[model samples]
Target: MSAVLSPGMGAIEQAALRSDRFRLEREGDWKRLDAIVTRIEKGRAKGLPDEDLLALPGLYRAVASSLSIARETSLDAATLAYLEALVQRAWFQVYGPRSSLGEWLAGFIGGGWSAAVRAIWIDLLVALAVMVAGTVVGWLLVAHDVEWYQALVPGGLGETRVPGASAAVLRETLFGHTEEQGMSVFAAYLFSHNAQIAILAFALGFAFGLPSLMLLVQNTATLGALLWLFADKGLLIDLCGWLSVHGTTELFAILLAGAAGLHIGRGIAFPGDRPVLESAALAGRHAATVMAGVVLMLVIAGLLEGFARQLIDQTAGRFIVGGFMLAFWLAYFFAYRGRRQTAGGHFA
Candidate 1:
């Protein structure tokens, strides 16, 4: 061997070069070993500590074993190549672990709640404004001609209907299913509606919670109008019994979905210390979890709407079911959630 003067030569580089030759000579797989070793040396130069380097020997061994197995098993060339790539990726991920689920959930809920609360206040104001506007418009409609108003609201001055004869028949047809049949064809309607509501709620977040708030108000007003109609027509008690069976759960889910939309909107409006993009991402995850819970609630509501509500026509039975659903929601949100906290202090 002849010594050649090179200004670029360094102690660590020389050591790495020697290490590479030794590894190749011992392993007799210079091509692959050299490439992996070169990458590790570069990482070390970039401040990767010794612990990471020491950890790599095990990773290399594992990859070697996996490749040997693949060869022995006669795996297809493409598959074996993919497995090799996966081994490298898994090695880095395992060594440099990232955030855990609990951490992610905490960040999501913490940031999401802050954002949601701000947006919710604006949403409430918007809702009140819309209700005032609607009231004015409704008053005008009624004032224009009492006879026309009477036509629109068949129950007249204060009458309303719930689970109208046709709606009840449809509910019966949709919900009446044997356990052996397992959800039947009508179950599709329930699932699809729940999915549709969730997607709409999520998509409307782009509108800054305005759309969601409007949707909630529109639905609430319709319910209010119906109730007023029923009361006018001496059917208030009957309508209450008809609605209470599934309305408690169904309405709660819709409201929660609206809340999620509001959360996303707030994240966009006020990012606090975080970048808007990051805040939005965090909000999205929390909203997703909340939306999932809403979907479940909707499923339960659908079941009650289809089967239990129809089966129990008694006013007392409907009241009990509705009361229980309301209690459950209040306890979960106001009681349990209120008791939790963040890293800094108690939750709001």
Candidate 2:
């Protein structure tokens, strides 16, 4: 025979009954929600039927409420954990970001890169002007005094043609020096050297873009002086053929990078209506994409200068390759982009 329980004991017994009743009332819904949430995780909600999908947010809210009530009522640990886990998964499905990596990549390729280039067109034009001016000055200086060749061109790059070299010597260097060892060494060095300049031009824009401007001038000046050297040797056509293969892309890549740096500098130096920091941050976001593309261009330039220049010794062939690449880039950026933006707008 059992002893008689006191009123407080009876109240404790009833509270336990109430907690059990709460779990019993909600257990089925919790399990169903868990199943749907699991399916969502696996299938990304694609397999979920309409009703089941519609019910998810409701179920999520129900589970959240249940979790709160369980904590307040001091429910069993197992039941609380079950509800907590369910709610977590459901919350993510309902409220977290909805984009996938594939979607973002597709969007970026579709219009993001080109759109960014178009946005900074003015800065790019200015950068191009600066480079052209530098080239002209370099050409004039070298033409006036051949000694300036020693000052403008690096010792390594100058190894092929020098201050007092004859036309015969430059011809030998240009058309005859396709020997394996010399060509290999020169190509490797040239690619590595230009890559450094390309990266530096963009990186140095922080010094009020002045440093980048100077670098552009120096690079262009060097080209001009080299042109004069080849022209003096009566090998201007040959030199043009050699450079045409990769110079178009390489020069454009460097200018784009310089433009990126300028964009950042302008933002910081003149934030206009916004705060300096915020203006800079926004400009950086846009310029960074252009810089990334510029790096890609440099890599292509390096490859053309390396293997193509080595194998295709004909000047005509080099020009053809360069022309094709320029045409492709122009069409990709303008033609394709313009088709989408009609007189009003339309895709061709």
Candidate 3:
């Protein structure tokens, strides 16, 4: 027996047939685009033939156009949905700004960080001068009165590293016994401690920078007091050697942190023609980039402090390692030109 459809039923059937025909005509391009997008997403794009790679943009545009037509012509739900997904995927493959993690890291190390640092040269100079002043202030305060040592040095170090801890005892602290197994733990602790200082220095910048400046001074004053202690005991050179191993990187990291904070403070304090918040936001972005690099610097410092400083017994050797690191940083930040610089003399 043959069945006959009513007029309404016939119209619905005709629509279904049109939708199927539409999908059949465009499904090939859609599938090809899907395959290409899949390969790229899975990191297999390098294996794709040159022709397929070259045709990606065209395929994307075609799929996008099909999606538009599908939406306007009120096509079947399945065809519309498939076109939407394919177009979206092809759109990303064609015009997305997505980059792999390794590529991002490479770009950052190559020029992004150094450029940000260079952008804040003025802040760096200001921070350096302030730090030097802080060290001197610390030294002078302690020199005028031995009691100031107690105030400047943290209580944790005060137990053994006081004003008159005796030459032998103080010297021992500089060249203490080390267990290889414990070095890792010690390094982690040092990283955590220094990171706190660096981050605090940066985070405090939101308060118009006064707190940040004071923090910088206070921290360095502790260094100055320690320097005086060792110097008075006639172990100044030895102490210098001990510190140089990790101090170069550690101090540089702190310096950047302090500079970053100062930049934000300065922006807020002196917004020029821009609104205070706008200026601060700009400064924050620039400083944030510097701070990101500072974290990496701190990691290196931790390794040096925990391992290199412990393993290398010679004062000269420590200085050599420290000096090399300092020189490397200097060149990378100021002299190295890995990419073209922008109008502001920043790497782009």
Candidate 4:
């Protein structure tokens, strides 16, 4: 064995001293993390105490930092290998494959989706801004020149916006007599249409988000044109009451779908510290959860549009129903997220 080196020695001696001190200070933490990871690898994370689980993420991060320093300093071969292997194991524990379907599903409904939504509040705000701009532009243009109504809205969907449909015709169209199947068919059709729009908005986000933005603009433009028509007939308030019965939830669902798309687009544009592919993959996970919840919103909206519009017929009742549902969503995504544990029960 070499003689003990004095303080302030040569460069090699200094590096050796630092490596030794580093191990001495952190070996205990590494061992504890290794043990926890071993238990998790054996599928025993459920058996870990809450305190132990809570400590895992911090320990894992510390180890990662150590690994980075070790690599940068060109530590001894054995030290470097050990640190690398340890970090890999801990990483698998902290961010690896999920445990089971039932576990994930339970987590999702409990708070996972809401938490995901809250995380993207900024994106959602942007989507709402874009949508509102489109709506405002559409309302102003069609209100200024009625001919622009057909130019903005699609021909098939603009049956309610013919050149000279009187107030009574448009009013009947709102609370109108139906074809063979009544509200059931109408509800189903609305759900299908909205689902298609929402899914398309989400799917098109990968095209750098432009397509999703355009789609939103088109949808809101049609909405604005219709609003102008209803207003012209001296039924603006009544038309709002009719739409409020379901439009709040329906439009909000589409907005979330658009946000999901924008997230993917942003991941592509700005990956930050992560690789572009990895960033996009992470965004996909969160966006998928939001889209899943959006489907539920669409269903609720469809039911309200079909039944509430037909049965209630009163503006206050419509607003009350829509407002209550909107309040519930607001609370679900914003109010309850902070207090819940994410997946792995604090293991993350």
lDDT of each: 0.57, 0.78, 0.83, 0.81
Best-to-worst lDDT order? 3, 4, 2, 1
Q: How close is candidate 2 to the true structure, as a TM-score?
A: 0.69
Q: What TM-score fits each model?
A: 0.53, 0.69, 0.70, 0.70
Q: Please write out the lDDT profile of model 3 over residues 176-204, one tens digit for every residue.
A: 54556435544565567668889999999
lDDT string for model 4 (1-348, tens) is 534557769988878877887788789888989899899889787788989889999999998998898899877788889989989988877888555767666677778888889878878998999899989888999989999988877655536556478998877766643342436554566667767879999999998878888888888887888788888888788778778878889998999999999888888888899999999999888898899999888888887777776776577887788788788888888887533335554412
lDDT for residue 127 in candidate 3, whole number 0-100: 82
What would the C-alpha RMSD of candidate 1 be, to one decimal place? 11.6
Lowest lDDT sum, 10 consecutive residues, model 2, at 339-348
Give every collision pair in model 4.
none
| Candidate 1 residue-wise lDDT, 219-322, digit = tens | 45445554554455455676677677777787667666777787788888888999999998887766766676676788888787667766765778778999
Colliding pairs, model 1: 158-229, 158-232, 158-233, 159-229, 159-230, 159-232, 159-233, 160-229, 160-230
- Clashes found in each candidate (C-alpha, N, C closer than 3 A): 9, 1, 0, 0
